[model samples]
Target: MSAHFKINKQASMLMWTLFMLMAPLSVYLMLKNKTTLIEWVLFNVSSSPIMMTIILDPAGTLFSSTVLMISANVLQFSTIYMKDDKFIDRFTVLVLMFVLSMNMLIFFPHLMILLLGWDGLGLVSFILVIYYQNPKSLAAGMITALTNRIGDVMLMLSIAWTLNQGQWNILYMWETSAFTWQSVAILLAALTKSAQMPFSSWLPAAMAAPTPVSALVYSSTLVTAGVFLLIRFYPFLSSTTWFNQTLLLIAVSTTTMAGLSAMTECDMKKIIALSTLSQLGMMMASMGLGMVNLAYFHMVTHALFKALLFICAGTLIHNHMHSQDLRWMGNITTQMPTTTSCFMLANMALCGAPFMSGFYSKDMIVESSVFYSNNLIMLTIILFTVSLTSFYTIRFSLATIWGPSNCSPFIKLQEETSLTTPMLALSLMSVISGSTLIWMMPMNQEPMTMSTTMKIMPMIMVMSGLIAAWYMNTRQIKHVPLLMLTPMMHYASCLMWFLVPLSSQFTMKVPMYISHNYLKSLDQSWLEILGGQGVMSSSFMASNSMMKTFNTKPVNYLMMSSILMLLVLATM
Candidate 1:
């Protein structure tokens, strides 16, 4: 290893050690005391009313604990995954800043104070996404940054609006009649961070970053930041029924699109990214349903399993000489037993398989949606989404584990402690975190007794999804043609219902066009006319008038000067 790497590695380890130690203590403190602590008073701003209001609430502390847990393990995994890269130290530094920013966001109860961490997340994430310094990476970074900047602007506007609310701490605001509009802005900000529909293009593009960054981004940091914000804002949002309804609409649409596209995506990382998007939508929907704890529970549990899934995918891609295309891979179950086991387990948990970490939160979400719903259209969409989610999960496993092997001879995956240990840590959570978290943060005062139909619907959908995926992606079904056989259907599905083209590529051009117009008209023509050019033209006219008088006679010049002086004196 390079001499530089050791120093950077030690620094990274030290930083994560501090964060890891704090996470558990925060969770423990929250569980022990039903109250929250807001300390770390670093001078408050009089004008902006910003202060260091670091909250130690159950929701915030628990989410921060999850962030640090996943981040610490991802860092450990990166040491092995990125050991060969020359820029490993730079990656390590960006990751340190990345996790630090999320933690800052986690603890800050003041909206104004949290904006610092919000922008820090955007800046560090852009740098990380483009770390490779390649054309594709740069483009991806631009998309990710610009998309996230939407949330930043929304939050900024909310902060400005909150300035009029007398108190800067949103946690203390029990009544929000005057600031209902600002609350909408906060929800939209969370939507953008979580990459809900219309803003969903950025998450898949963010796979351009190193696998470790992707692992951290989708697992606990960037993608879940919105849900974390919404969870904290739950009390205030209860009054904003319109905002909740709008959020639910956007959330379900995002979930639907991600689910459909995931089943067709061949890129291993992109499928995972899409799945993360879908789950974020679920949490967002839960927020709309007024089940903030359920959303938080799902967010925490999903983080554990998803982080493990990404680590396994990263290792598989690395050992396969950095190919992320699932079509070019298969039957790794026989070759890399440990990674395959982790991958399958993670996927199963993602599908909310019985008693899994995902099942604990997800099944509750499903059952609650049915009991809590009257709109047949919304309920139908939710049920279909559950099935779609299951289908994608099964398809991911089959494509990478049971489908035809289409590559050259495989290289042995590293069986080192660094490589497998983190996955093992998370795999344990994937199996048990759901029940543990449900106990710690239950959905209701007592057990929620759901009807048989509500309970059986998810199982039926999951079973159908499994059967369909096996029918299509199964090695034994080699002779059976897939249902999405036509080129047009495949094209639509693979392009993510053409949302990327509409949202990321084409929608991005609108800003470019506006910027170009601003440069030409506002900066060039208008400013020049009013300021520099206007002064120069006036001076030139004056000079020409003086020269004309000089060419004529002294009397004419005297008369003109007298007339000009008289006009100026009259105006005054």
Candidate 2:
């Protein structure tokens, strides 16, 4: 017990020490020298005898470094933000675990180690989601946990498939020819982890957690794990035409559906959640097109801005005593100027405005989709997605920062120091992180410049969507018939539910009857199918047959007994 206690204490100290070291180390690496955090870590690992060196190509280095830098900053932010929270110790431990797992995941040379870190982070995220322990929050946490577990299973299957093909090594798996089944499994895992399409039902529900948990896990790390896996396994995915095609379809569908959902959402966190799903879709599409560097660039920028936005939203909610509905919020620009400013800056970044971090990375993705392989379908889908991206971004910005103040009368509010400090720091990062991406890691490829005509299209799309939103929302226009606008488009939103069926179909073809009526019988025979209907029934029948056979052998049993008695008398 004493030894165990000592080890626990040591682990706690090491966790804090690592965080303290990494935060300063990341800044120094990024600022003093232009070397990214991933390169530095990889260099050190390469030099170490015990730790196997994993050499990162430019794309891998870029992705890993960005994750490291953002994670470091968030960890620093958490120290201040979670200071006054009741479960500070537990929160810190999970935060440390998350950072450690992510870092190890990106850096590990072995596939097994990477999987360990991958699953560890997912588990920690689920725990953090339920940290609040409220009924609604717990329910949401369960959904998030279970959904992620499905992703985990898919990932494990991919790994097992790779191992079966004698590709146990991480690097070898990518280089091997046995990637088709592995890629399919990995893609399913990615779709679920990224909260794409039908699997996305858990994400909005996850908003029941505290805003910080949502910010870190949902917006940045946990959700983006899918994108990371895609990029990391890009070679395998790129090798398969079917994999790329499937990924592109899913990405486009997810982007369109999530953007529409974001538009309709009234809750601040839900908007962010839906926006997260949309952004992930964009990243996945980028990866599908073999634009790994661009995807990583966007992931980094998105993480910084999204984390800032969520923290700012949390500040607003915390000040308002947990009211997250945008309708109840108004004119807080003056009261919470720091948070409001942060929110606006982050929103602009999300919108992919010119010169912003999101703009550069997102434009690269769109341009890649347009130029790659002469596929007009990919281009059109991406173009439409870009428009919706801007539209929903504008909607989210307008709902949170624009319009009349509608503060509720009954709710008492106060700004806590613990919350505002993180919001202020994140706000500053949101503006400056774009410059870091542009200047620090200047792309070898020439930057794509948008023509006046090209620029006009996206702007027009944004404007039209905003106007439509205003028209639909206004009391005078609220009564306008839904048919006047795009009635077909509205109905298509319900088609998001088809994602569940589509993904299931990808795995197995469920009978129409089973798919339709399964819910009605979910409570009854669901366990039988899952547990062991065939095996249990067979076992019961075998036991009954054996009992009858034993009874029928009574004459043989009596004969054997008489023989034994005669043998015993002869011996006497």
Candidate 2 TM-score, C-alpha based: 0.75
Q: How accurate is candidate 1 locally (lDDT)?
A: 0.82
Compared with the true structure, what per-residue lDDT tens digits does model 1 show for residues 1-572?
66656755575477567767776776576556454666555564665444567776667766776777777778778887888888777787788889889988988878877888899999999999998899999999999999999899999888777766666686777554557778878878988899988888889999999998889888888888888888778778777658777888898898998898888888999999999999998888877777777888888899999999999999888777888998888877766888888888898899989998999889888887787754677777877888888888888777778777778865664556776878898899899988887666624533557778667998899898888877776655454434367787777777777878898778768898999999999899889889989889987899798887576777777987899899999999
Clashes by residue pair, model 1: none
TM-scores for all candidates: the values are 0.86, 0.75
User: Cα deviation of 388 in candidate 2 (Å)?
Assistant: 2.3
Candidate 2 per-residue C-alpha lDDT over 136-180 given as tens digits, one digit per residue, 9 for 90 to 100: 778777778877888888878876776544334445555455567
Worst 10 residues of 1 by lDDT: 474-483
Candidate-wise lDDT, in order: 0.82, 0.68
- Give candidate 2 regions above 4 Å deviation: 1-85, 164-167, 174-177, 371-374, 410-416, 446-451, 479-572
